[model samples]
Target: MGSAWKQLPEELTGPARSLAEELRTLKDAAGLSLSELATRTHYSRASWERWLNGKRVITEQALDALIGAVECDGPALRALWQQAVAGPSGAEAGAQDTAAEADADADAPRVAGVQDTAEPVEVLPAGEPEPATAWWRRPAPLLACAAVVALVLVLVGLRATRHDDPSTPVADPGTSSAPVTVPAKPVSSDPTCQAMGCAHKNPKDTGCGKDARTLQSDVIGKVVIYLRYSQKCQAVWAAINEGQPQDYATITSSTGESEQALIHYGYDNYSLMLSAADPAVTFQVCGHQPEGNLCIAPMSDPAGMVASTPIPVGPASPPPGVGGTASPTADATASPSAAPTAVS
Candidate 1:
């Protein structure tokens, strides 16, 4: 049988082409047929077809599902997908626009009495000077402009050849008039806090969730616990993906700092972050259920393996300067619960 895939449209360029090609490569590497992908992921075969064929922009949720199904680098893929959503680069768009205008001009209707074989003539209003007599079009001015263009081209060529000349002196960083550009370090999208300042702050609002990853995950009874850590924020938090009403998870640092998240109506909830710059300091996420308390810590494995320890049911000790108010849950609809007060 012939290949099921169609060639990406010729108009696709820049990030859009990149993302589509990367998706195709990942699909090929996974060796999963479209039918199998539909069964495994939330998106149907037709949705995958459109994304892969560059007919539609892929949603974040759809991308996440595909990444999970293929086990690819989620962060890198997400970044590429975001660039694609931002559309083509400025230069590419300009070129495309220019080509479109040229095509439109080619197809546009001509003047009523103008002959196609004749040299184009410009029409001028009565009493106006002809463009042929303009000062800028004079021989001396035209020669000057040509000379300036030639000088620019020669200078550019010399600059391009400078790298190959050993006699060329390197510019001193302190004395050079040219501006030296330093690559910018990655910053959180919209983080309100950083490092210690992030303590007791909402991970989502602080933009730490953008680069967060599950350090460890465990399933106790029906509840699934995700021990999430954000290297960018240097903070850790606990998320309860599945749980009962009144269920909660507390993220506590080895330094004795803690924050709790309560689930009131839904099965999902996430706690506020606790500053944890040092991974060796140890951060634990303990989920509280009616049955008992189950705790898990970040493992050395990058695979996010969860090793849990069941502890007796009890309230966690709160950090100093922290009040009884538990940071609000991720679900805004649910009312906040009475948090565990600090004990002296």
Candidate 2:
């Protein structure tokens, strides 16, 4: 952890650099120690160090692992990572090609205009043979080629380390709460227990029902409001979804049960799962390490829902950009109407 804690300090430009930075940020948001990450992912700590160094391009496998482990938006991160890996190298190659062509135009002699019917003349010194035509043999083109080669070598060197050790293997859903049919056996699979009163159970367990969907919160900083409807239990509860490193959201029912979740994967929106709460409920979103916990509570809703029109919320705003105060009946915070008496 000593040297691993320190990030790569070299000045890297383009996609590799950006990808490296995002990977480090993802690790931070996950809150897992390097040793723990090594254990969970079955990857060596040294391998992670290389991955974060910005010298080598991360493969799809590593990228997938980071996405799944952190519960991030996979498509979004994959797009960014692809840009970083392909962006710089392709750009540099194109740039070099353009520069070499430009140098040839500037350095080589050219005719003003010659028609295909006219014969071109080749001028050569009395004792000189034709020069080598290899593009890299020229001064300007050679320099450009050298630069490209150096970069390729650096990237290759980083990846070559992987071949040096072949032990690590890498490989790599939000929607709504709707009425679910209760199976006679009530087979619980992937239940997300998110509230204070809700028992945290595995989605695979036979407790929390299967219905899941994410609702948008209408606010300055887009908040994530997750809804879970359990048919077997015949109850529904809402939980705050978070993914940023600092910000969080929570809700408390009139019965005093509260559920909270931290932001995830540098995402403005996060996912949360909770068992339904008793009575009416209220919610609050807050930030971390501030002098005080400045939390904003959204409108509370009756356990039994009312006929209210859905007020759609947009992509969440960063916590600092948020405005206005939380309201008890704010359209942004929609509460669920119902829950089963017992999850079993």
Best TM-score goes to which candidate?
1
**TM-score of structure candidate 2:** 0.30
- Pull out the clashing pairs in model 1: none
Error of 2 at 82 (Å): 15
Q: Write the per-residue lDDT of candidate 1 for residues 1-344, one digit (tens) a residue.
A: 11234566555545555667777656644555555554344333444565676554555545655655654556667666655554433123211223333344346322111221232211112353222211111124554455445435543444454445554333443762432222222443566777799988876557665555445556566555656666567777776643556888877776778887776532345788877665456677778889887877533322122223221111111111111112211211111011111100
User: Could you tell me which 10 consecutive residues in candidate 1 have the lowest summed lDDT?
Assistant: 335-344
Model 2 Cα lDDT, one tens digit per residue, 199-289: 4332213334233222212222233333333433333333332222355545444445555544332222222334444435444434332
lDDT of 2: 0.36
Q: After superposition, how far is residue 71 of candidate 2 from its true place, in Å?
A: 17
- The TM-scores, one per candidate, come to 0.35, 0.30
Q: What is residue 83's positional error in candidate 1, in angstroms? A: 37
